[model samples]
Target: MKYFFAIIYIITTVAINAQETHKRTLKLMGSRFDITVVANNKTEADTYIDIAVTEISRIEKLISSWDENSQTSKINRNAGIKAVHVDKELFDLIERAIQISKLTDGAFDISYASMDRIWKFDGSVTKMPTPENIKASVAKVGYQHIILDKEKQTVFLKIKGMKIGFGAIGKGYAADKAKQLLKQKGVQAGIINASGDMNTWGTQTNGDQWKVGITNPMNKNNVFALLPISERAVVTSGNYEKYIMINGKRYSHIIDPRTGYPSSGIVSVSVFAPSAELADALATSVFVMGKDVGLNFINQLKGIECIIVDEKGKIVHSTNIDIQDKLKNE
Candidate 1:
């Protein structure tokens, strides 16, 4: 009888240990935040995600120019006249943005915000803009005009009234930073899914990798592909966010810095890269680059891949996409 009781106790201990798991999810930074940490104890993982949320929120404030008193707005207000020193994280992100602009030949410009909102996404814009309007809009859209004084750690928009904002890459950078914080906190496996911009690491409970679904452009209710992912980031950009109708044609909110016009041709573009920052910037660049240019640009990029859907509803994927066989779409 004693031996039988001891065996039952041993089995109970094993079952309890097997049931151990941890996950945390919340609304933060105007987006969804999800965290999964695999450990023998749930308390430790929960504590780590809490710490990560606080750190990421601090960064959002520093870089969010939309906030009335953010550090970036203060810098934009001062412009070239005075340099406002920022924390290293903000400074580094801006610096990297400039590099991406140069690499993509201004396709991924941060200074594109300097252009006025004459190209409204509302239904009121019934016709295309005149040549004069197009020319004037791009006058301040040059990426080269974004001035960064490395010595002083200040970001200056050289053109007066020009602005710099991270509407494109902010979420991705935040996700990347948050993932780093989690890894530093000893999280062995997890995902930080910021909206649709997700950064994943390690494997699932069954030893399989994270499976990410690519939404079908033609049918929002269906997924066209199920890609297995691990230790990577994916971000999607599309006209679904905002648009306008002109001459019975839909124009996306994304503008081309070169043409001073809202972009079209591609309905959506999702990029996968080693870090969320790259995925963020690439998604925006690909949207502005249009279908052909965007596809070529992604192909040339190392440590990166993409899934691009054209306005005609045709899907194009990077040569390297690793989709699973179990659920191949028709």
Candidate 2:
């Protein structure tokens, strides 16, 4: 009996000290995703991430506005004629996007895709567009145009050619859903990095917290900070990464729906929230809204913080934000 008790104690000790790391990376939705977890075994961690990916893929099939057969596409197709029933998740996402649009004073709009692609940042772009061209671009860009029926769970685009998409927000939504799915699947430690939007939970295998690197907008190969965080999502949006430079000026792909022009003043916006989905959408909103209003908007919200960096590298932070260290070799 004494030997049995001793063996039991040793087994418990081993269990306490033992941790396994699992990582799974895959390409889906035209992006790269890396998920890692520290669990009792490698298989469990991988399984958790796989489950999350499956959930994301299912949502993509249902909600992708680009996919012609998707429910959202069907809604766009049936505009002005009939209301198309949609998945509950897609309905919820659109509703949240509309709310964000209202909260940001139309800075965050899903209908921006309906705008004309007039202000191209390509090398071919020459002189500024005429006032009429700029005015016409925002013609179909309005959140009020999206009509959703609660009882029927249906969506309708009020105007023909007016469309909605999750380009700026889908990856974050995927990350958030994956995180919740991971937790439900008995995962204690893991992270879902859907491109620049990422969420993490619990500790690492070494008993230390997870460290996330914020990529430097100025330095492509450097990180601005090494944040030791858990149970939080970080999203970064920057023009320096995907913008086109012409006439000694840079134009970002992220357009402001209210102005029908690309955002100016702010260069990058990083938001930390409870979930990646929220963080992602809010980051883009803040970027287009500029520093003052954007930071104020984020600070007013609970559990949301932002770091705004301008073209000159001057940083403005929300109420509870931290930038531990600047980028090395920037």
Candidate 3:
């Protein structure tokens, strides 16, 4: 199995010949969600798409840290005071995030929300932050400080201001849940794209595989390759749009939780995995780990492949990926 982060934002799904593919674009979870499904009739497609929208909304209510009434907000409100009991679904998600944190050695941390906004990429700051300021920014970021009580189904933060936010992994998790809900309802094929976090199952109406175009980071308009996929998740994390160039160095919006510094050297990291949730978090982790370390880590994982584009626009893939056949014919 091969995987890559294609320029999904610029390419829409296409079908060969005439086919009935119903699609709806909506704003959900604070991102552009394009939900497409293949069905024999419009009513069936609309109904199934509604089910997906409802499922994704339910997840947002349970995990959104920004909403005061959400369980996640409640967990943050009581930080350093007491453990807040939560629903089984939210609890399990947090538990899995903690496990990923350990796997990446704090590079992928949910506690990153507590980081201070000392560095800005809005073209505001002219000089790099002082060493002391950078050190102080991540004072509250440590995955070990998050205490999860499995028996009580509660979450506790060891510090008063420490918080957990799913900005990096939430959309992918939402996409995965939505896809599972649709499949359970007997929907044969569809694509759930939560911003750039996408999940697909089955083929198109014409029986052709789903084609995803990989965008060249150096030349954004040109697609370097086209990857055919089915029943898998593809997530791309890149700093190309959100970054600041200072003294000829490009600093991305993705920050390294370990150092409180913006990740540099890599422009984009696309991950392919069994689920969008894992792919989303791992893609961000690869950005922080850089090319050598990131490629090695991805190669060791089973059923996970990644494509990393370095600062110089050179493309690198995991050990299993071969570009001979994946390059787009067009």
Candidate 4:
């Protein structure tokens, strides 16, 4: 599940003389990417945006499981057959994904790609899967079975038919990488919004901090708060858009890989962190962790905050974030 954000800005007198904000929205990595850059003119902004597009495309080819020639596909094809050597970048990404799996106690697992897709979010489903079928659906899904060789920079899956994919983290990682490359090229301020995974650097053209309006889960067209963020990443995972009802109960599209069942109890989770990659992973993790456990887990981590909206429309936030002050309707 992904959420959308509204970019808020207050025009100032400096806008006429200062660098202007140029944005281009295009399709990249099978998702919509809105790349915005602050530049003196349109040509320079287009140049910077093109560079970011190239970088994002490169990352997609490296990690996309659908592309048969990608290194990730090679690794999946050789599962339980042999250890396939991969580039250091891909190897390191897999290693970090494993670390996150352990930290979340298996709440977040790339190996979840191997699970059978028994739960459909489309409106056609009228009932739920049985206990036995649900249990067997996740038989091949286990991160513990994934083996990494640091010496050879190889990845090996111990079980046949086991695979891994980065649907949750790939876009955010691409956004972070694009932002990094643009920054190195002296693009002072920009935003790479890969759907709802947003990363911002520097400030707006008017020298004001970039702000994003948090969408109200109860009403998709309304916003509850507008929070100013600088040099940070924010990601929101919500079930409001994609979910199914069975026996008058709603089940989110975000399935818990361990149980082979869709997640419940929470409607949305928004996480703020230093990087979009971390924020993306944590947002999904919080949904699976439930409201209470997720809030506790986030409170323990420094430099990280989250806001959760339960099914009852009740809102709760981490220790560091004060939503009351940012409420747009207040």
Candidate 5:
């Protein structure tokens, strides 16, 4: 459940049109959020951005596990005790997360929060964890144990120490919710960038599609491609920013919840889909699945494309996406 930095950079220029693009940067869900909206004037744009901020804050309060008063916390506190009734929105979100867990065959699980922090990326440990300890770390981290009742609107963890958190998908869900609210309020175009969990609708003020620059995992300062996106979401999960070198091999901070060990081989994964929530989850899933299996998994899904950078810095993409044609070499 470690959150990575934003690897997708927004490519923007000064707006020359009457309808200007307004942007505001702030902290939401314990991460950075960049909200941009196209409006007739600064006042209107600010109003729209404020609305997005409010919506994101509301979502954080509902889903944040760190908040003791949050419904998510209540659910965790009641693990193996009783089924805790939750709001319909949270119920649906958890339900969707469970479906994604099944789709990835448990590669993407919200119950990853139950995992013990045995592997440290802070360079405090000079050696890898014991195999037995590593195995035990994930004993309580199984999505299958999360029982949900639709009719009762309740969520229950079958194990006593089991817990669930949304560090991976919460920001994306917030971005999607904010975008939906802004669009319903008559905002024609906007981009909600929750760290790297970005969602866009409509186009730029000049009618061109919004561009996103994909960072080269080998060179964090370098951008390799610029992809034009409209009415879509793109999320990039990279291990370049947070990792440790052990026995001359780099270990990513993104651990595979099933194995209880940090993921290896793949350095970065970018996923583009219809919603930021799905893209964010799949981005992490691809990292856990490694390059070959991850690429194959993404290729099988329609309307979902992925770009992966392996440990050797080799770039591979899904069938529907051709980054070579769009490479900027920047």
Candidate 6:
């Protein structure tokens, strides 16, 4: 009887320790990164986290247009002058981004870097830009104009000032790459949250799926719904944080590359997909596409889902995603 009770105590203690979750927070890629992993020891978790950080930084250097020495910056600097040769990694990433632009009908464009910032969402703007000004703003912003020479492995912007930047999808790409690297290193489960672009694999220590909450755009502190996810990516793009009110109307910071106007009618769009890169771009596209068109587009995709909150504070979800109210359960 003494030996039996001792065995039970050891089993319980081991289980408790195995369920421990270790987390590390840092700033990377101009965003707050919250990395979490379930591990048996602190040393193991720290090692995996460091690997993720290094991978993210490497990707940022490769794709950052702001960095004068980055490959992307070189491509932009030579716009209309010559085709800039680049590595296969950047070439493939740009190809994929262009594909997404076609799918979204230019709603998701990387050439937005060339857009004239004539429309300001700041509180100072009391009037809208004229039609001619709006049209001219996007004259240099078109995905079709971004030429990719597959045979020569070069990227060329047809217009002299035309440029491509990965602001919309860069963080998510970093998250995906970090997750893949950690998994390759034999890390069972972890989450890479770049700002709000979160990608997770494996389960929690308690053997349950990770729960992600969709923040209520109206009440920033409260979550409207909770989503259960495993080996999936969820990205939320909301304009609530950066917007300006003018004459009783609210304008989001996200401007449509097609139109020089700030995206309106939608407060937030959260996307879940197999890859964080896709989810991130889609979230921004949905915000520009508005609720009805965005939901329709998401519903057609096999493994993609979306949740949109409109300006009226109404919560909407794509056909496949059914959100659970955690507050109601509580």
lDDT of 6 by residue, 18-80 (tens): 546788989898778888877779998898899999999999999998899999999999998
Off by over 4 Å in 6: 1-15, 326-330
Candidate 3 wrongly placed segments (more than 4 Å): 1-6, 9-19, 322-330
RMSD list, candidates in order: 9.9, 9.6, 3.5, 2.3, 1.5, 8.9
lDDT of 1 by residue, 134-183 (tens): 98987877778777788888777777777787877777788888888888
The TM-score leader among the candidates is 5
Best by lDDT: 5
Q: For residues 71-169, what per-residue lDDT tens digits would candidate 5 score against the true structure?
A: 999999999999999999999999999999999998899999999998777779678989999999999999999999999999999999899999989
Count of clashes, each model:
0, 0, 0, 0, 0, 0
Q: Give the TM-score of candidate 2.
A: 0.88
Tell how far residue 324 is off in model 3, in angstroms: 5.4
Task: Give the Cα-based TM-score of candidate 4 against the true structure.
Answer: 0.94
Compose the digit string of candidate 3's lDDT tens values, residues 1-330: 011234664234455554478899999988888899887778989999999999999999989988999999988888899999999999999999999999999889998998999988789977889989999999989989999999999999999899899988898999999999999999988999888788999887778778777776777886776677789998987777778888899888888998988888988888888899999999989988888999999999998998877888887789876443454322
Better of 3 and 6 by lDDT: 3
Q: Write the per-residue lDDT of candidate 4 for residues 1-330, one digit (tens) a residue.
A: 334433222222237755888989999988888898899899999999999999999999999999999999999999889999999999999999899999999899999899998887779889989999999999988889999999999999999899999988999999999999999999999889888788999888778888777765786666676677879998877887788999988888888888888888888888899999999889989998899999999999999999888887777889887553454421
Higher-TM-score candidate of 3 and 4:
4
Shift of residue 164 alpha carbon in model 2, Å: 0.6
Between candidates 5 and 6, the lDDT winner: 5
Q: Write the per-residue lDDT of candidate 2 for residues 1-330, one digit (tens) a residue.
A: 000000000000112456876777787666777777767776666677678889879777876878899987888788767788888888999999999888878888888778888876555776667888988988888999899899999988888878787887888888888888888878887777776677888877666777666554555455556666789988776776555565676666678887777776777777888888788778888878778888888889998887767776666678776657753434
After superposing candidate 5 on the true structure, give the runs of residues whose Cα lies further than 4 Å from its correct spot.
13-15, 322-330
Clashes by residue pair, model 3: none
Candidates' C-alpha lDDT: 0.73, 0.74, 0.84, 0.85, 0.90, 0.82
Model 6, residue 130: distance off in Å is: 1.3
Clashing pairs in 1: none
* Candidate 2 RMSD to the real structure: 9.6
Candidate 6: residue 35 lDDT (0-100): 87
